[model samples]
Target: MSGTIHSVSERFDFTGDELAPAYRAAVDAIEAGDLVVMPTDTVYGIAADAFKADAVQRLMDAKGRGRDMPPPVLISVVESLDALATDVPDAGRKLCEEFWPGPLTVICHAQSSLMWDLGETQGTVALRVPDHENTRELLSRTGPLAVSAANTSGKPAALDVYEAEEQLGESVAVYLDGDRVSGGQPSTIVDITGETPRVLRVGALSLDQLRAVAPDLTSDDDPAPDPTDAPEPKPTEDAEPTPTDAAEPKPADAAEPKPADAAEPKPADAEPKPAEDAEPTHEVKPTEEPAEASNKGENNKPDPDVRPAD
Candidate 1:
């Protein structure tokens, strides 16, 4: 069955009155278990009533996906998460608080009481609250819708309704044209079913950004280790001694005297002598001429001879 395309205003009032005709048609189609292609914040999505197993199957068939792969559920408000999931962890609530109505899909334990089968979801379902105004209005009237990227299983996801129509052909019952959707990567997928929340796929929301809300949130690219569970380092026999052990003083009895302690005694005779006398002695002899010495003696010889004779 070829689908009919309806033109929708980009800035229409979402009070369920301005786009009454389009909303009426979309709600009717979804209620009748028919597939509808709609725009989301990240990309265009083909949606169906989440509670209707036949509608979900038809959605999977349109995407050429099998029961092994399940479609994510799109909710109008954050409160819907409580109804859809059981044991919604505090971390999951934190992620919804920070990134919901934007581009993050959280997977958690599905409500056991709900009568719905999304293929091989394994008792868990992925949910998101898109930021698009039109989609939110549609969700308000249609309740939770089982949604997936509007394209074939292997093909690129449609950024606009026309591309979705081209890829899906008549598989979708209604295509609400909301003009060209700002092209961007798909929403990030995070599974909070385990003790440690893990990111299955990275897309619009980054791991670091998600960590801001849930510090324990982990991604396939970077896994964080739990500090409390880290193992304490074991001491090895060859391990170096600690500073306290090495700083300890040795016993005084075992200490040896340093080189400054040994003194040699000096003998009394080894004292230094007077500097003047210490020099070598020399003989003092007058260098007088023989004639001068004889003259001097002859001049005094007469007096000396008279005194000797007396």
Candidate 2:
């Protein structure tokens, strides 16, 4: 929450060109378990030590986020995938091999001892290998970083160093301004929880582009409701009910007439169904209709006059 701004990449300033020192400072803060807001190819992100629970909690609190949505953990490279996630499926590996160091967030099941408390993980976590050089270098020095876009809840994401500084204010220990972002959008998030993969959030990558890299990719297909509102319930139409009169039961006018002849009950024999309603039995023929047609004129019998000489 208290620190300095370091120009760690081209996007921040020309000084970030040799960014190891500033990145080192951010790494030091992370080692001491403090938050660092740094630039990714997409937008500025607030990061904390993945193993530091308290630091992670501060990140969640700072963003005014809930447990349902956990912060994603960014790794330096794809090799770190197995360290934080489980069951690296073919689809997951395929995508990682293809578009990883770009704008793609792969959501997979988390390993049990990941050590950070970002939110209610429900045994799952999101991970990404960022494309930015400063981030890669910082993550190389520091381990996996639990991070999200550096902005207050519900506000637009930070597009530059100043925007991040203005939005994050005192929440993050340091803001590493690299410069203008590589791309102007967030990462394309894909959830690989089920047997089939689902895109949780669509960002820079298109649905077609994602599937081309990983053929098995499918989308969850739910576009979220408008951010401005909790939808109001539709009103129901009111109608009036018609009243009915109560009636009293009347006695029989006279004694009921008796049957002229006594009827004998028949014995049950498959229970006589109404004659018209009985199910009919069908027989199966050896040669089917299609097979008979296929044989056609090939198996025709010889004519009597033609067979006489034989």
Candidate of highest TM-score = 1
Tens-place lDDT digits, model 2, residues 1-310? 4233333322224144677667767877788777787889898898888888777877777777776778999999998898888987888878877887989998898888766677788888899998887788788888898998988789988878888777767666666777768687899999876667789889988899988877777777755777557553332222111111111111233111222242644233324334354332232223344344434322343332333221
lDDT of 2: 0.72
Lowest-sum lDDT 10-residue window in model 2: 239-248
Q: Tens digit of lDDT per residue, candidate 1, span 1-310? A: 2233334312222334467867887888889888888889898899999999888988888888998999999999998999989888888888898887989999999999989988898899999999898899899999999999999999999987779888987777777877667846999999988767899999998888988888987788774777766664543443323333423432333222222323743233344334444322222122233335444434433322223111
Q: Cα deviation in Å at residue 172, candidate 2? A: 1.7
- Model 1 clash pairs are none
lDDT of each: 0.77, 0.72
Alpha-carbon deviation at 68 in model 1, angstroms: 0.5
Q: What are the per-model numbers of colliding residue pairs?
A: 0, 5
Show the colliding residue pairs in model 2: 11-178, 11-179, 12-177, 12-178, 12-179
